[model samples]
Target: MEKLKPKLFSVMKNYSKEQFLKDVIAGVIVAIIALPLSIALAIASGVNPERGLYTAIIAGFIISFFGGSRVQIGGPTAAFVIIIYGIVAEFGIDGLIIATIMAGIMMVLLGLFRLGSLIKYIPYTITTGFTAGIAVGIFTGQIKDFMGIEMGAMPAEFVGKISAYSAHISSFNMTTLLIGILALTIMILWPKVNKTIPGSLIAIIATTLIVKFAALNVNTIGSMYGTLSAQFPTFAFPKTNFQMISKLIAPAFTIAILASIESLLSCVVSDGMIGSKHRSNIELVAQGLGNIFSGLFGGIPATGAIARTAANVKNGGRTPIAGMVHALTLLLILLLCMPLAALIPMPALAAILIVVAYNMSGWRECLSLVKKSPKSDLIVFFTTFLMTVFFDLVIAIEAGMVLAALLFMKRMAEVTNVEGWKYIDEDEEDSNDSDSISLKKVPKNTLVYEINGPMFFGAADKFMEIVSDISKDVVIIRMRSVPAMDVSALHSLWNVLRICQKHHIVLIFAHVNEHPMAMLQRSKFDVEVGLENFCPTIDAALERAATIKPYKK
Candidate 1:
């Protein structure tokens, strides 16, 4: 299991102080970066900016303290932007709290059950497509803030949101635009001068100073949303209705799935940087704890942030202390700088998101999929992206993934036809485990062909193509390698038998597995082909074919 899993306790206990110091430094830097991001994400998610800080502080701390990765920093991320916004708008913050808490519990349970390793089963294309889609949605949502448009009470639906954006286009404020661009520029240029400090913090502080000293009439967070309270979050309850829970279960599960995917992916990336593997199950449990705390503390959902994790790694974070330090840093800022934070420009936050959107959006990945990926993968990728942008993430992921799977199955089946008799030497696989099976030359008028892999609908065409290529007195198809058969495949086999009858060639199915034989028996195919013609093995089939080779049926 070392190839897939970890002994969670050992990894945690092996931590050293040297790593802790580095982690602390990295954590401090990440905290600075996460500061504006947390508030911005929370605001975008339809809650007060403080809730974002709460997630980064409370949830972030819990995740880092007990999480799987040494350097993973957890909090509200851009990926959950669309979902959290919808939940809050539909059922209010109370509903969001309950859902997050429930999902957390679910995650903990999943880890305890050791299902963490199984999460790798989720397709890569699904993650890539939806991530890109989210990037686009985040990009679009920030347009109002960046352009300083007054989109009052934006709708929850994508179509409605677009209409509202267009309607408010005339109200764009240039001062907000200037603040946003200035912040964006500083964010871009500051890091080159000092890698130790985060560009985002510098940008926020710089923009806040300009607005305050200049007495700009532009809407600040304080001007627009009122001042943030300097109080810590208290415990709260959304609701306990199982009926409501049932409805939210699917969403909660979606959150859990997303959390697993995102956290594990972050862990993988961090591993590349540090050359150390993470305890995935332990990390999952830690994430669960973070989510639970987030819900309890009036915070939004949280997960491992890839960008933040990468930043930590790059900044010399080598242990869990860095993640913990990062959390503490946010807490210190929230307590000390809450009121001062009110003066920050919303447009500046919007600019950060636009940059975030660009970074997160896999537009390049999407283009590559369209131009270079196979037809099935391309279909799955684009379909997932379209669904995510136009519809809810839950729906988009569910439908897009299902469609991709079906297409994959169809393709697999098409390549799995009967190919026993004609020429095994020419089409034989190289000296590998798969290509070990073969057949010698048969009688002049006899045919023998072997079938391979699972026989499903797609294999129907291949099955037909193989048999149609042969013209002999008798045809014997081998089915030794075929492990299972679908109904469509069985029917296709029967039809080929009928074709052999029309061609006046004796048709025989050899060495069909017991499972496939039962299916054929249920469909009464055995009666039509005759019991004697159905050989128990390829050797028996070859003997029967030789006997029937010289004469027409």
Candidate 2:
């Protein structure tokens, strides 16, 4: 109960005016960085540009105020690019909004249940695989926009989209292409000049000016989507059905998982920067509130942004004031500069997303993993990447997880094998040798058994194969190397013990390890094996075997 206590709403002690000013400066700079990104990400997610600003305003403010981490800036991100597009394309924007709301509720529930710490149980290989897949999806989706390719009407499916792109190669607009290239190059080079102002913003300004001044034929936002409206955001409830629910469950789950991973990661990063640990559950709840408000205000789904958090830390923004100020900055921009946004070029926005996909892909790390990691990891990694390219993200993640789990099982099985006693190394120093029993002229109706290895279901069947020839009145089962048993194996042991009792065979569990013994005690394996027949070593089992011998009636 104490561990689950909330802290996100609490105020910081020793808050200073100087730090507040720094936070404001940092917030404004981040708003600049976020400005272009929010639009690009929203466009990628299949929504209008204004939705992104709404997310930066609503989710941003909520996350800053109720969030446990001081520096985290929450908004739509690359992680949601593929998932949101798929949802909006298949089920439309209304269905997407409903799903986002569902996902928000789930995140809040996850935190309230104090499952925040358990998100780490998701394996790194699995996360890496899906993340790489999402990056590929985002990259592929943007090619049409960046290259100014026209397909009249593009298909949503991956293969169809590619085929359409290929067929329409003749429709590429050189003017748009030039603008996109200019935007991309300028964005890549801008940070070297000044970190205070974002590269994407500079790129947007440059490309917009060139296209406008030169009177180029390229499509500006005005020509493509019409003039921007200065109006604030509005909310609407979605009409849902069973089919929509079934279709959206996968995307909602994906969003929840990515949100969980990215949020915790941002919290950890902030903790390292500020030297203050965060309450994870409280942070998650705040995330849920942020997402809820974002979806309501016509924004895409959001989570903690890592780069923005780092920026907040570096600019001397040590408290949530920085994050809140960032929200206010975006709001001010939305209200004042909404009309001027029409001058922005569509290809330039696409260029920003291209850069986003590149950064998210983590190509250098991906290549390094293939070079240095085990062959199995590379297989899972590439398999996920191709799956995203060819199919959908849900299938990619599901298949990658199955592959990783199979490889893990095979590794464990390799470490857990059985060997005949004669094959044991002569000079080997195993503690099990201290319990070996030597019995000469054994009784005809008696059996001596030795068992080794883990008692999991995978290894449980081997015992049956070993004891297939047994037809004895009394049998001693040696568990010299058995260390653990899952519930399935425990039940199997219980059933076997009952069968032995039915056959009038006195059974002994010999040389049991401490851990397995505790499990047995908890599961009441003692009642089935019998108190008298249980032993810590084979020597004790050998002596106990004497009293169990029976004469023919």
Candidate 3:
């Protein structure tokens, strides 16, 4: 087992003042980048703006202190916006807290069990689909604030949101729309002028100052959520009941899975940047603890934010210290400067999220898959995407996984085959390959059959159907091409053995692979068929078959 140690311990042995300065600079830069994002993501998740800061200060610190990645920056991310919003709308803030904590526990268990590698088994198409779907959801959710549409309460469902938007289309405020456009323009163009400072931060500052001085009739965070709290969140226990747990369990699992995927993905990106490998299991454990503490402090769920992690790496963040510094910096901002966040125009935050949605959409990858990928992959992609858009993420993942599994089985079944050889003329036999049965003499009243691919449940019936009608005095079964066998295929082989015995025919086996051979030995099928009948090669099987006398009909 890989040691369940945090990366910080390893990096601190050679720590120096020079590197500390670099880490601090990187940390502060990343914190600057995270400030606007955390607030925007929290508001988008249907929570108070301060809760986002709490998540950043609490969860971000916990993840960095104990994480496996040297430069992982954890906090609230756009990926959680749709799911968090849905949870808050359905079950309230307390329920969201419970779900997040439950998810944290689940993640810790996953890491302890060393199941972090299993996350990679989730198909790429499914990930791509849901990411795009989430992007669409985020974009859709931001429309009201972006357009400054006056509506009672936005619906949680996609169709409901669309209906609500259409109903309130006439309430669009021009002043708010202009402020949003100004922010969007800044977000797009500011990066070109200055690469070190984040455009989103500039957009927020500029738009907020303009809105405040110009007295624009636009919605601000202060107008909606009131004065932003500068104090740290007080720890509190969330109220939970058996019924609420039952209702929220699915959502909780969804959050855990999403966190696992996103955090590991961020770690992988950081590893590539710095040429280091992350201990995935321990990283998962840290993420679990982060979310657990975040929820305890009345914060939303969080994970390793990919954009923030990359920014840390690019800005000379080389160790976990950088991540810890980033968290502490956010804490300072939350304490002394949080009140200034009140002046931030809602449209500016919406614009920042719109950019986030666009970046995360992976439209090019989706388009490439549609144009070039296999039909089965395309099906999984479209199914997941459509379901996520029309229904919810949990349903989308369930359907996509089930559909992908069925399609995979179908493909496997197609690959597995049972075939009989056709002997060439004696004059042309010299050209045949060494393994070719034509190179070996086949006795009269004997047949040779070969099984190809894995012998699993998907192809078990086909194996039985092909061998059931055999009328030979002796049968040579070749399985060199078989890599594996399952119980269903073993049962089919047992049936074949029974049929051979009933017909008074001899059976011989040839070239069974390691896995199938082990299964056969375990099942005592080798004993029933006679161990001498199992040969290591086609030639050996033929010799054994030749020694057997033809049974009389």
Candidate 4:
């Protein structure tokens, strides 16, 4: 419950006028940076330009107001572009809104249950694979706009989209192509000249003015989507049926998972940059609330944008106020200048998204992983990457997790071993005292075996085989090195105890750790084995075994 506290409250306790001024300046700067990006991302997601602005204004404000990280700036990021586009294509706007709302509910439940940290368990290889796959998807999707190819609605799948672009290759507009290339060039070069103003905004303003004044025959947002409207979004519930809800469940889950991952990752990055810790659960709840509102307001899904967050931090924003100010700034633009945004050239937006795709791809990380990671990890990476590109994100994530889990279990099983303990010479034992646990001479008629690593279902069979084959008056199981035991392993141990009872062989557990001990107690195995038979160390177990009356046939 403590994790539910918003970071804004803490920052406001000592808020100063100087800090407020700094936050305002940083917020305004981030808003300027976000303006063009919002429009580009909206258009990229197969929605009108103003929906992006609405998301920035509505979702951004909610997240900043209730978020866990002080410096996080929330909005529609490049990561959501592919998934959002697919949802819209398959289910239409109403279905997309329904899925988003359902996803928001899932996110809220995850946060309330304190399951935010669980998202960290999503494998790095899977994230890398999907991220790279998404980058390629985004870049591929923009090919039509970037090349000024006149095509109708593009296909949702990567292959179909590519084929369509190829078929329409001859329809490429040179004017549109030149404008896109120039915009890309300006974005690349603008940082060298100035760092304060965003290059994308400059590109948009410049390209829009050129096309408008020159009367260049090129497609703009207005030409494609119609005149921009300044109407504020009204609360509207999506009309849905049971069939639609059932169909949307998978995609909604995907959205929730991705949103949780991206938002938490941003929080972690912001924490590192600011020397602060963020409550992951609170951040998740904030993201969930943001999405709920965003859907109600006819906007796409939103999450903390890492690039915008970094910009806020770099510009001296040390509190949530900066994020709030940024949202307000976007709102101002939406209310006053949204019509002007319609005049922006589509090619420039395409160029901006292309750069975004490149950055989000994380190709360097992918290359590094392929070069140095284990073969099993590489397999997971490629499987996820290819699946995401050719199939669907939901399938890719499911398959990747299953494969990763199986491989992890195989590795664990391979590492788990049961071996007989042997005596070491005194001089050798002394030299290796810290590294190895030395054993004294075993008591007569006693068989001792040591179990190493976790005793999970995968390793249970081997444990049972070794113990069941022991033919001795007394059996001592050493478990000092066993870190944990699962139910399957416990059942296996129970079988061993039953076998010992049937054979009239005394069984003793030596140096069992807390987890195994608790399990044994809860299962009443300790009582069945006789509490005295469980010893604190191997030596004590040996002594107990020696004192046991000889088993008679």
lDDT of each: 0.82, 0.78, 0.92, 0.90
| lDDT winner, 2 or 3 | 3
lDDT order, best first, reads 3, 4, 1, 2
Q: Which RMSD does model 2 reach against the true structure?
A: 3.5
Error of 4 at 170 (Å): 1.6
Candidate order by TM-score, highest to lowest? 3, 4, 2, 1
Scored by lDDT, model 1 comes in at 0.82
Q: Pick the winner on lDDT between candidates 2 and 4.
A: 4
For candidate 4, lDDT tens digit of each residue in 1-553? 5568889998899999999999999999999999999999999999889889889988899999999999999999988888889899989999889988888889988988999989989999999999999898999999899889988999989999989988999999999999999899999999999998889989998999999999998899999999898878899998999999999999999999999999999999999999999988988999999999999999989999999999999999999999999999998888888888879999999999999999999999999998999999999999999998888789989999999999998899999999876555666565544534453667778888889999999888998765555567888899999999999999999999988888888889899999999999999999999999999988888888778878677
User: Candidate 1 or 2, higher TM-score?
Assistant: 2
lDDT of 3 by residue, 1-553 (tens): 8668999999999999998999999999999999999999999999999999899989999999999999999999988898899999999999999999999999999998999999998999999999999999999999999999999989888999999999999999999999999999998999889999999989998999899999999999999999889998999998889999999999999999999999999999889999999999999999999999999999999999999999998999899999899999999998899888999999999999999999999999999999999999999999999898888888888899999999999999999999876555676665546777667778777788899899999999987654565567888889999999999999999998998888888889999989999999999999999999999999999888888887767
TM match of model 2 to true structure: 0.89
Better of 1 and 3 by TM-score: 3
Q: TM-score for each prediction? A: 0.83, 0.89, 0.97, 0.97
Error of 2 at 386 (Å): 2.1
Q: Between 1 and 4, whose lDDT is larger?
A: 4
* Candidate 2 lDDT, 433-472, residue by residue in tens: 4544432323456677666667776555555543444466
Model 2 per-residue lDDT at 479 = 72
Model 2 poorest ten-residue lDDT run? 417-426
Per-residue lDDT, model 3, residue 452, is 88
How many clashing pairs in candidate 4?
Answer: 0
